[model samples]
Every structure is written in structure tokens, then in C-alpha cells.
Target: MSDSTDNTTFDSEDLNFDDFQLEDFKYEAPFQPAPEVQRDLSFFKSIPVTVTLEVASKEIALGDLMKAGEGTVIELDKLNGEPLDVKVNGSLMGHAEVVVVNEKYGLRLVDVLDSALTGVGH
Candidate 1:
């Protein structure tokens, strides 16, 4: 390479924000919808994501937690037959119910979270 200096360096002070607008800086999805009115979200389809079904949560005293054993029973906030919260990558995705298929425990989707709430596309 010649003795030319590189201008690729990034400096926050070098940016001009005089014409910037909050709307112009809003986030947008990387993909677009299909022509058939379907969402073409195959961009990150192959990426693995962690899914968790939250049954319930309860806050117990430290003494009670320390005294818990194999036979110990703890109460949760949710009642029996209540729907469980389905989380994707630690974000609330939807609500589901426990189901048994092929002798395997699974979750049956009950309701999907709204796109607006999940920030799925907007």
C-alpha cells in the first residue's frame, strides 16, 4: 500500500445531526412482506432461539427456601389449568398450554402476542 492515510476511522464528533429527525432514525425490519399478503420473515429462520414455558412464579421467604426438601411443597401465583407464558429469547412471545403429543410433553399455542406488543415488525 502507498503512504496514504485511512479515512475510515469513525468519530462521533465527525457526524452532523443538524438535519436529523427522530422519525428518520426509527428502526425498521430487514425484510419485506410477500406479495400474497404474507410475512416473508425467513431472513433469520435458521437462527436458533431459546423458548421457555413459564408455569408460575412465587416469592418465598429465605428461611422457607432454605428449609425446602424433596417433599416440600411451594405455592405459585397461577392456579391449576392456567395458561402458561411462552417466552422466546427471554421476550414474551405468547401464551400456551401444556400438551402431550407422542408421549412427549409439549406446548400448544393458545394465543400469539400482538406484533405491536412484541415489536415483531413495526
Candidate 2:
């Protein structure tokens, strides 16, 4: 057999396929599932996953980063009042907004990710 992009040529007379056999095959044993394999998925349900909420990020020079003080402020790439990204296990799951819940800061979900079809959190 040859590919379309190949430039090499072969001599058909040098090939010999007359000695091939088809009836000599035999099965040694029947196929079976392993003893440790189980249909239950209880073990996967107990696993822990990390959930994270991102606010903003910025990159600055090393010299500028070294001159930081208690009153110093570094500007981020994201603007204020933008929706925050909610990630699960390092993947983007959805977006949310900051809310006040009984004097405590909380995240109110604005969108939920659907990963059933594409298998991607984003």
C-alpha cells in the first residue's frame, strides 16, 4: 500500500502473498470481565472538588512590584462592577456577582454552565 503524498515507487513483482493462511487461527479462552470491576459509582461521589471565585488579575514589572506599600494600589485588568468568574477544579463553571448576605460577603450566581454535551465547564 502507498499514500498519495509519497513519491517512492515499489516493484509489484517482488511481493509474495500466495503463502498466507486463514483457517489456522484458534481461540485459547473466552473473554471475561475482571473481578475488581464493578458497575456501582459510589466511590466517585465521595471525591472532593475545589471551587474558586476570581475577582481580577494584573501583571506588573518586578521592580514596580517590589515598591509596594500598605497604602499602594495596583490596578487590575478587569473593570469595577464586572461579573466574577466561578471555577470548579480550575475550569470556568459560570459567572456570579458579589452580594451581601446577613453582613457577610456572598456570590450570587448569574449564569450556570452546561457541560452535559461538550464536557467543558466553560
Can you write out model 1's per-residue Cα lDDT over 1-122, one digit (the tens) per residue? 78988779899998887867867677878897667765766665667889999999999899989999998889899989989999988888898999999999999999998854445332
Q: Which residue segments of model 1 deviate by more than 4 Å?
A: 1-41, 116-122
Q: Record all residue pairs in model 1 with backbone atoms less than 3 Å apart, i.e. clashing.
A: none
The predictions' CA RMSDs to the true structure, in order, are: 15.9, 11.6
Give residue 16's lDDT in candidate 1 (0 to 100): 88
For model 2, the stretches where C-alpha displacement exceeds 4 angstroms are 1-43, 114-122
Candidate 1 lDDT trough over 10 residues, lowest sum: 113-122
Best by TM-score: 1
Work out the TM-score per prediction.
0.59, 0.56
Model 2 over residues 3-119: C-alpha lDDT tens digits?
668577789987677665646867578888679744665566667888788998888998998999899999998888989998889898888998999998889989877854244
- What is the Cα-based lDDT of residue 45 in candidate 2? 61
- Residue 29 lDDT in candidate 1: 86
